[model samples]
Target chain A: MNERDALRALAADLPHAGDDAAVVDDTVITTDMLHERTDFPPGTSRYTAGWRAVGASLSDVAAMGAAATAAVVAVYADADFDEADLDRFVAGAVDVCDAVDAAYVGGDLDTHAEFTTASTAIGTLTDAGPVTRSGAAPGDALCVTGEWGRSAAALRLFDRGRDDAAADADAIGTVDASNGAVERANELFRFTPRVADGLALAPHATAMMDSSDGLARSLHQLGEASEVGFELDRDTLPVHPAVEAVTDDPAERFELAAHFGEDFELVCTVPESAVDRVASDCPGTLVRVGSAVAAEDGITVDGDPLPDRGYTHGTE
Target chain B: MNERDALRALAADLPHAGDDAAVVDDTVITTDMLHERTDFPPGTSRYTAGWRAVGASLSDVAAMGAAATAAVVAVYADADFDEADLDRFVAGAVDVCDAVDAAYVGGDLDTHAEFTTASTAIGTLTDAGPVTRSGAAPGDALCVTGEWGRSAAALRLFDRGRDDAAADADAIGTVDASNGAVERANELFRFTPRVADGLALAPHATAMMDSSDGLARSLHQLGEASEVGFELDRDTLPVHPAVEAVTDDPAERFELAAHFGEDFELVCTVPESAVDRVASDCPGTLVRVGSAVAAEDGITVDGDPLPDRGYTHGTE
Candidate 1:
């Protein structure tokens, strides 16, 4: 069995085993580990690395609609690791915590053969309580926060020399920003967890999960947990303009939207009656993607089978 | 600056940033990272690795007299890491949690170049609020739960061909046990956290900290935090018999007792009036080794200067 399977088998008897974060009393706790080789690209900045690590964990808390309160970080680096890199990393972590209004609490540090980060985020539930992946019901409206495929497009842009096009297309609509689109996209690679959107949608969401593992995998996970399936409308997938600029074929861009992970967007199923209300209440754009169906129908997009090709750690 | 300095510099603005664990309401959260090259020695069992990683984090909770509720672990290993080792590791974690009356909640697992374990422990405070290191005052009777120097002696035994001798002296009173003394010492290598001792003393403890970083370093920390110094009686120091067997020099054995970390004992200060009551209430042997003094006096043992030579992360 893989790491996921091993942990699942071991914790099968525990409560809140498969949820985004374990809930004890009113607190929600989640942890994420980032390895230098797997999670960081060649040109990744230390600042981005720290933010991404902490952000990934906070995203899990956000996925549950919990208000993140604090974060604890553990960093392991080689003996000769640069001090400046560590400073930038710490700056990134502190800055992100400031952005979310959470405290950057103290954590442990050690030396290892390579750079690795493990961050844990602690959050508390609002009065609405948590929104779990198993709460979806048949006929619920499927929705996602903001656009997708920007991270994938950014990667493609980085592969080419079109830093200018990459920056312009992936722009969160900001001009004269110091960083290029590719850098911004990379910055948002595992972008903000939908903390605000989650809080707003918690009361309306029947089921919710972060699309860190791609829309397809997250949908599959929610379906399996909720004992339902999903049917998506290809035209409504909210592919980012950067994806269109990078890919020639519309189908490829849609596929990237469906399968590119680390968008850090929330994919939720809301009651059909509350769909418009949640969308209107969310801070960012909320796109209607599809609807939940009977389990026997299985997962599909425009009546075609959608593959679970999202990034799976260790396998990749 | 080291990891501690770096995090401190970054989180200077946050409340409770330097505590052993960050407190949120009634809960305590702390994290620890264990790297194979540094934390795990040759012949270390996967079971031991898992237990040590989880136990290390739990120790922080114990230092605060919290009731451990659950733990989340993040394991990063090479792609080709042995499956059996992983299973053993999980089993070890579960066993430790069971021992501590805590649930081994689920965690994340991924592949990396080397084996690294990062575990976060969640706990709830008892009726007594957290016993922080800064709570001590002048003239408090300084006490430590249980004996020390076993871990250092065990290492010496392991270094020599005297595993049997190492295990024998460090045995936790093998009244009706099957494992040999050496085996017992090995088992206690990453000893159990002093949870019960911490709880019993919390109500009366003026100040509390763990001996994970050795007695000398912990005393210095307590001194700095509480603005009080420590005067330890060398004769009163509860040096384990294993230390005596491992080293011939009296000064060397005392040094080991003071400087050997990872004993997982509690170093606490109690008011003179409550000293006897606290000692009697303890679950294990409680030794009165010293008294808290004015900060101007500084920390010393037998009126001699004490050195902070305990185990430190990133040093190995």
Candidate 2:
């Protein structure tokens, strides 16, 4: 079965299974699995992998509008895996946890044919309770945190580096150039999960979800869950500077900004009156991109239907 | 680096990283990773894998003398993995959580080259506070819950089944016989983690740990952590009925009982005065196998020094 089907089956057994994080009492918990082949591309550093893997689960905690507490990551690698790579991975995990004031508690280590990681993050619910995806109402302002398309830009740079290396097999002196591209890609790949933003918006956000699956897919998820539609202003969508560095085509830029995921930004809805208050309370920038509409109106971008297209884990 | 070295490095970064579960205020959380190659033998079922993987994490929570609240597992399997097998896996996970009164609050699924699982369990600390392996006194009673060597017997049965199948490749009629052995092995492999026993012993016990490693290794670990030694009575060690069914030799039985791991039993230290009270409070059989002694006296079983040996993840 595909992941969606498997998740559906799981939700039948667990009442809180479909949420970004399962809320048990006042604690929120979430787990994520990332495989080497699917998650890490060629020239990806162990540090980047560690950061991204843990950050993904932390993002789920953020989506729940909770205060991030702690995280653990299970690392599966070959028996003969390089020690330095492992050290770098742990260092990156620790750094990411430190970035959000959460502890990187210990996890398990096992030998496998490929490098894989499963991360679990725990957070405490704020007094406002969890801002679930099912609470958006008509007239609520739809907003997103930070810029988009950073991960898309990183992927483009990685592909360019690979192509350059393929074209010059004998050029040993070009190693530095390829390495530079990898460093830049890694920089873009690493993102801070918006835990503080989630906490700040907890009282104001009618509904909230993360854009790990891109803005369009997140909107679709929130709309379906809340039984509301959206009307967005495409001009208001914040495109990351990294996207312009990689592509100049307007269509490509729009595609990357709307559909390429891994931004780790919060997609939320706030009452129009609370927008100014939320903006001031939020630790980071918040861009108002749209407003929630009646369910029959359907989701749209500049009067056009917004197709539900984004990153989904491949089953084949 | 080996798992031990890797853990040591982690402990240096986080103070609570060395324990079986990290205690953050009232919460005790733990994660475990198990791979198909090392954890599952031939003819193993996905249901058993789910049970054992999640059980391992719950066992860590038990070691902390806490009340298990919930668990989540991340499953990584091939894209074309059997749907029924996945269903059985989820059923097994849910059943185990039900056994411990903990919620199986869903998990993540991803495609990978091998079937691997990483499970995290969260528990709430009791009024006695979180029990660590460092609180044993010299005169405390060294005890264990339930019998040992079930996993060892199951492994032997698995090997026997493999050998029988290899010898009778053309014997289609013997399929049921092989399957019966597999069923028996699976039964032996499935074990209930000692969460109840841990909670019951928390008020009276000084130190506690689960014997995922053999009794000998567990004692050594508790010894190192608590700065105490032990004198064990070999006759008092409770061996599982399955172990006797598989091995007739006395020495072999002893080896399996004392050295074979994955029993998921609690190894604990209670004050001598509280032993009777603990026995009455504990839900399962309580075997008083030894008594903690001063560190300089060293650990012995039946008047001989016990070896510091048990299962350690391979890093070859």
- Window of ten residues with lowest summed lDDT in model 1 chain B: B171-180
> A1-316 in candidate 1: lDDT tens per residue?
5756766754566676678888877788888888876676544577887888898888888899988887888888776766676777787887777777677776767777667889998888999999899988899999999899867776675444344534557643333334465465555454666788888888889899998788999999999999999998988888888888888998788777889787788899999999888889998888899999999999999998887678776566
The true-versus-predicted C-alpha distance at residue A143 of model 2, in Å, is 0.6
Clashing pairs in 1: A167-A181, B167-B181, B167-B182
Over the stretch B295-314, how does candidate 1's per-residue lDDT look in tens digits?
A: 99999998988876688765
Stretches of candidate 2 off by over 4 Å are A166-178, B164-168, B171-178
Candidate 2 pairs with clashing backbones: none
Return the DockQ of model 1.
0.52
CA shift of A219, model 1, Å = 1.3
lDDT of 2 by residue, A140-228 (tens): 99999999999889988887777667677684334333466778988998999999999999999999999988899999999999999
Candidate 2 per-residue lDDT, tens place, B17-134, comes to 7888998878999998877776777767778888888999999999999999999998988877767878888888888888898999998888777778899999999999988999
